[model samples]
Target: MVKHGEEGLGFEIVKAVLNGDIIEPITFQKVKDYCSTSGIQATETHMRVILSNSTKNSHSPTYKNYFERVGKGEYRILSEHRRQEKYFWLNVDATSYEWSFSDLKVGRSQIYSNTNPNGAKRKKETCFKYIQIGDSVVAYETGTTKAITTICIVENKYELDDEIFIEFKKSVDYDLYLALESLKANGDLKDCDILKNHRGTLFELEKKHFDIIRRMLRTLNASGDNEQDLHEKVKQSLADGSDERRARLAKRDSVTPVSYETIVRVFKRNPDVIAEVLMRANGICEECLKPAPFYRKFDGTPYLEVHHRIRLADGGDDTVANTIALCPNCHREMHYG
Candidate 1:
């Protein structure tokens, strides 16, 4: 807390100067200029004390973490509450826009077609008007391949006579693209403007939606040999089917050469063991106590599988004492569920 006697015109000056500049570092002279413009009287030392103290600095006297010193005579606002990073989705149609993902990677500003040139000039319903520098942006390829292919940070943005242009910094293109179906399955991005209203070129993405897509991209692009990587790949493969990859596969022969197989060695159980287990169940599942779904076509007997209380692979004997009859549903649940 700023002590009762500590907060003066300098405290107000600091607050006014650092109101909205969260990412960029501001110099001491900038703070001084703000104070002068606002008609607040404060010395340089007083301004420094408040700016340095904001809890992020370990040596700060005040119990606050509002500001962080970035460089010599420069500071930026500290997101004390761990604020979520702002994210935007840009729809890039190569058919209409001359600039491509390559242009963004080379630090060229992207220009989108503007329907109302006068509206952009007047800042009325303009797409890029509210986008500030340092915001995260995901570029989605539209028209043909519907996937998010590039991620970048907004370096600068402006509205021209008939178009809105925005520069990107640290733009990156991942090997994997996040398809629309994959994103929708991962999060509630279907509600976003890009899907709900496709006419718009730029749309604000919710933090949750952004987090989901970013995580999937990072996990897919992660380089390592781990169990989790395999699981993520399986999940991603289930969710996505790339047109190019599918086309390549379609050309190849459907049946490929058989390779080595994994066969589990098992003990040959006595026929009487299964007979005894089935006889004990009396046409009912031992687990769920439900009757068998149907009778066998050949024998007219209840359909059931003899399940060992302890799996045969786990060293259980092939005795009736260690076996029970289960319907197909219960048998599948025992193995998978």
Candidate 2:
């Protein structure tokens, strides 16, 4: 415990500075004024010494972390609690909007045409103004919100006489055409209320719920992509393909005719394992603690290859606990180092 005289003096001074103002971020002069009679004497050096002593003691209750330096010599009383920035999840009805998830499929444009509700096409009943750019959009089946079908990011909104035209930057649920039924098969859908009721609505969602959606979509899409890539690679290696590289490889072969054989093996890769490890690493190689060497050509996500700490060929299960994100150099080092 600190002694009660000069040793404990700065605590009172800090308290005065904190409670002195109606609002926080008070001027340093106000702090000094409020703290004038708390201690022995008032001089330029004494004031600096008290503040310096108080802030320097980080373990002390009157530490500088309790306050923030906003302006020159001005401090703000900072609250102890902090939270992430809020983002909203919006609900859009397929029946009301005259839209479908099919419109967001591969190679489709980013525009979505939403029709105005009957008798709601006037200048006064403009609730469509509630939606803004950068909000999330979720789709439900035509008549009910019992299930969420798709998700998209708002890009632009244009209002016309009988309809509202909304554009999306990209959709997380591109390949999903009415996914609610499948979701119901996995989990109970009766608990969703906001998802069932609103049209042109923006309701804030918890981070956990948002992550639930993101994880499902991210893993699903990545698995599909990896499967496609594997197929395309096999197809390119086959000499019968239309690709020029296959023909060139065939021509470059020696006089002993080589036979082509197709061997299909199941690639049991866990999408969630790779996705979670990469996200946790945040594009830095786990082995080197450096940023990835390059970005992916398709998406701008930093290219850190996922590796298994225990070799999969050695009977390791595909799981995040057994996986890591590493740059190409570190990955090669792991195998051949």
Best by TM-score: 1
Instruction: Give the C-alpha miss distance for residue 145 in model 2, angstroms.
Output: 13
Show the lowest summed lDDT stretch of 10 residues, model 2.
256-265
Runs in model 1 lying further than 4 Å from the true structure: 1-85, 102-109, 113-126, 159-164, 187-193, 223-337
Supply candidate 2's per-residue lDDT for 108. Answer: 36
Candidate 2, superposed: residue stretches over 4 Å from native: 1-101, 105-117, 121-127, 141-150, 158-166, 176-178, 182-191, 195-207, 224-337
Model 1 C-alpha lDDT per residue in residues 65-130, reported as the tens digit of each score: 455566555555544423345778887776665555633443545644334334543222344655
For candidate 1, give the lDDT: 0.58
Q: What TM-score do all the candidates reach, one by one?
A: 0.40, 0.31
Task: Give me candidate 2's TM-score against the actual structure.
Answer: 0.31
224-274, model 2: which lDDT tens digit per residue?
Answer: 555656434533333233344334434553322222211111235544445
